[model samples]
Target: MSTPARKRRGRRAYIAGALAEEQVARYYELRGLQLAHRRWRGSRGEIDLVLRDGDAVVFVEVKSAPTHARAAESLRPAQVRRIMMTAQEFLGREPRGELTEMRLDVALVDGQGVIEIVENALSDF
Candidate 1:
């Protein structure tokens, strides 16, 4: 079979991403953290979302791939570096905030419309 042309992400993928982001936000909200930002942008990079979990400041990275493996895999080394740098820039803008409690988190998506939140999965940054 002629390899069925790989389906590029279109409206459906966009919808999935949006839905995942929203669900992640809801989860963080229920956990007592306020969703301070959604799709926050900076010169260095873009942060998917930010939440305040009590005294903690969380920088969220939301990934919505077809499967959990693919989704989690997307957060490769390069991407992590960018996210970290971007987070630094993001924090620079809010110097008054508590930088000591800053953290980076990932929200991975599966094909079943489920989101798995992985907190501090990476130790590097």
Candidate 2:
């Protein structure tokens, strides 16, 4: 049950998220990380980006807003937990399995399109 306006807003959010992911992906690519997967999802949750940085795997969560602080604040603790769980699921399915080092990172995109990457944003459980 949805109204046209709500549907439109949802579509706009999806487009914004897609743009943010693309911007963040390019930023990582320029730094030599290969794109392992984009929008990796499991029953646990969805990870915005999964990248291989050398021998380590980087799981990224991208947030976009009018300001960096706003974008950073958009991520909830529950969401992080889900992302971490999804990351575990992703790793278990990988060919390398749990052999590689893994890290969680966050990428914030501002309205002006500036990209900021926060590395190792989460501590391992």
Candidate 3:
């Protein structure tokens, strides 16, 4: 049976998500953070992009929205909880040892080519 048009649109949406992630990763790298991983997964959840700065590992969440408001709203409380859980898992698996100095950062990509970055957007859970 042929897949419906809706399913095809969903697949396209997923691909766009990947492209936005790459853009955000590059944006962070340009700002001097070392790129560690993208779409990094742990048992708890997935971190969109993770970067290292000296001794600190920063867990990043990237939101790509057709509108600025939509992008900012993507960081709902429940979503933050999942990212926090994933960060804990990442720390436990880190070979570098010290994970106490880590923080969470957020990147929002508006379809109009505007990018908003927030560091320490949310307090550790």
Candidate 4:
């Protein structure tokens, strides 16, 4: 069951997330990376953004919160696993398949719309 307040909150969150993703995508695009996909979903989970830097693939997860640190902390371990699984599924479609060079990044957006990108944030996971 969903209440009106809950629904409103959910809608607000969705809008915020969309805006955050857009900001992150632009950030990468300005860096010369071409946008490959936005909100790309696989059987495992959804990847917020996917970009191509020459021959390498970059998977980005966007998080928004009142502060950059809070946004960064929002990514849970379980989510990391799901993102990894989804990234693998995404790679399966590439011509190089599993051999395709890729990296997972986390983009954090604060309420003030400040952006901070952490490259290879999921490599250890």
Best by lDDT: 4
Candidate 3 residue pairs in clash (backbone atoms < 3 Å)? none
Among all candidates shown, the one with the greatest TM-score: 4
Positional deviation of 100 in candidate 3, in angstroms? 3.4
The global C-alpha lDDT for each of the candidates, from Candidate 1 onward, is: 0.81, 0.91, 0.84, 0.96
Clashing pairs in 1: none
Give candidate 1's whole-model lDDT: 0.81
Candidate 4 lowest-lDDT run of ten: 1-10
Candidate 4 lDDT tens digits, 45-96: 9999999999999999999999999998899999999999999999999999
User: On a 0 to 1 TM-score scale, where does candidate 1 land against the true structure?
Assistant: 0.83
lDDT of 2 by residue, 13-97 (tens): 9999999999999999999999999998899999999999887899999999999999999988899899988999988987788
User: What lDDT score goes with residue 114 in model 2?
Assistant: 93
57-105 per-residue lDDT for model 1 (tens digits):
7999999887888998888788788788887887776746445478898
Sort by TM-score, top down from the best: 4, 2, 3, 1
Give the TM-scores of the predictions, in the order they appear.
0.83, 0.92, 0.87, 0.96
Model 1, C-alpha of 45: deviation from truth (Å): 1.0
Positional deviation of residue 23's Cα in model 4 after best superposition, in angstroms = 0.7
